[model samples]
Target: MRYGTLDWVPALDRPDLLAAPVTEALASWAQAAPDAVRQVLVAEIDPDQADTADMTATYDLPLEASANCVLVAGKRTGEERIAAAVVRATTRADVNSAVKKLLDVRKASFLPMDRAVADSQMEYGGITPIGLPAGYRVLLDTRTSAGPAIIGSGIRGSKILLPGEVLAELPGAEIVAGLATEIAA
Candidate 1:
């Protein structure tokens, strides 16, 4: 697959490009998912340019073609709740309202970076929804799951390319409308 100036290769052939959990998830998925749906593409990138702005500019990828996954948490009745919200780079997750309501919490906030990284076992700024912990809700903003887009590879050194339909079908993915709001230009 070709995305902008990058040549994307099958993810299965480049396990080093994926985080441990993502590789494990892909392995399990291969046994049950259709061959066509198993097509995940990846491209190498400079880790220093992994941030959205730098990535888009440096790699010649359009901003809209990228998605970001963020971790949010809240508490209700003394029980902790967590969710992963995937949204387009051009927008921001509506964690204060949509996510809080979905999680049935009175208030929601971003999970601390330390906790998010430790719990997901993914790099900060590179956490993708592909292999989130099973217990956490995976919320897919409508725009993001509809891919043919770029996303984190669970590592800063690479990016994953996949279709939206595939993302919507990810394990535990809950496709939600208005999960994200576009940012002002």
Candidate 2:
């Protein structure tokens, strides 16, 4: 759907949900990577019900929204590392192909909701790349560098705004091509 300026919704003015899991994650990320964290601007949204449409409308930005996928690997040796990948709303993270190869794990998959919630200490819908375990390998899609993007805040009702470049600062972030593709509207 083509949205006009009139269809745009205003950005939320404050990051008021301090107690939210996503907010907590953001705070943790801020302490770990102050420079990277500074680039993000947090906003509140309905984490449980929010999706690309709600995000696009609420942010009053173009439909070209940026998001990061949190991929966790479960190794045969019983180790897990959270990985972050940036992609546009129109594309899906190439987890099986790109992520699996990058992590050098025999198997890589999306973190189960319960595990993700526990690991990130954020609600299922609100997981973001920041504040994850220091060992976590964050991978950013080169496309994200094109502009500012929004990512989940480790809670369902909030998002963090920042330039895509900040993603590079994560411990093991790698920039790859064709990590995502546009989804039909």
Candidate 3:
């Protein structure tokens, strides 16, 4: 299948395009929602263009069609709470308010890049909600699940394309309205 000038193949058919954990989680997704998982596709790309901005420019993909996943964490009474915030590239996650409130933490901030990569076992620029730790919440902004989107494949060398419906159905996914603030033009 081709989407936005990129050749996309069923992710399950080409595990090499996904990170190890993404591959594993995708298998689980297949079992839970065969049809949805079947819609998930992957396309290899240059590692240097893995970030949302670069990917959009290089591939002629609309920023609004791209989903950016950010890892956020906060400490509450000695326990650590973490989540992956999935929002459109045209907006930023409301971590300071929506996410913090959701986690019931006094404060919330992006997890350090190194820690996020290590904890998620995914590349920094290619972090996606699909294969995060089971305990990590997947906070999917409502906008992301409203249409087709391009998201990380859990690695820097490829990207996944799927409908918003598929992302909304990920295990542990929580769709939140007002979860993001649109960026100014």
All models: lDDT? Answer: 0.88, 0.63, 0.92
Cα lDDT of model 2 by residue, 1-185, tens digit: 12322221222224464334444555565678876666666666656545767666765656565575665574645666457766777677877777777777777888788876777676665666666656777777778766666676665676666677765564456778876666655
Q: How well is each residue in 6-26 modelled by candidate 3, as lDDT tens digits?
A: 899999999988989999999
Instruction: State every prediction's TM-score relative to the real structure.
Output: 0.96, 0.73, 0.98
Off by over 4 Å in 3: none
- On residues 21-132, what C-alpha lDDT tens digit does candidate 1 reach at each position? 8888878777778574457888999999999999999988989989999999999999999999999999999999999999999999999999999998889978988878
Looking at model 1, report the run of 10 residues with the lowest lDDT sum.
30-39
Between the candidate structures 1 and 2, which one is better when assessed by lDDT? 1
CA lDDT, candidate 3, residue 108? 99
Error of 1 at 14 (Å): 0.3
Better of 2 and 3 by lDDT: 3
Candidate 3 whole-model C-alpha lDDT, 0 to 1:
0.92
Model 3 C-alpha RMSD to native: 0.7
Query: Which regions of candidate 2 are displaced past 4 Å?
Result: 1-37, 74-81
Decreasing TM-score order of the candidates: 3, 1, 2
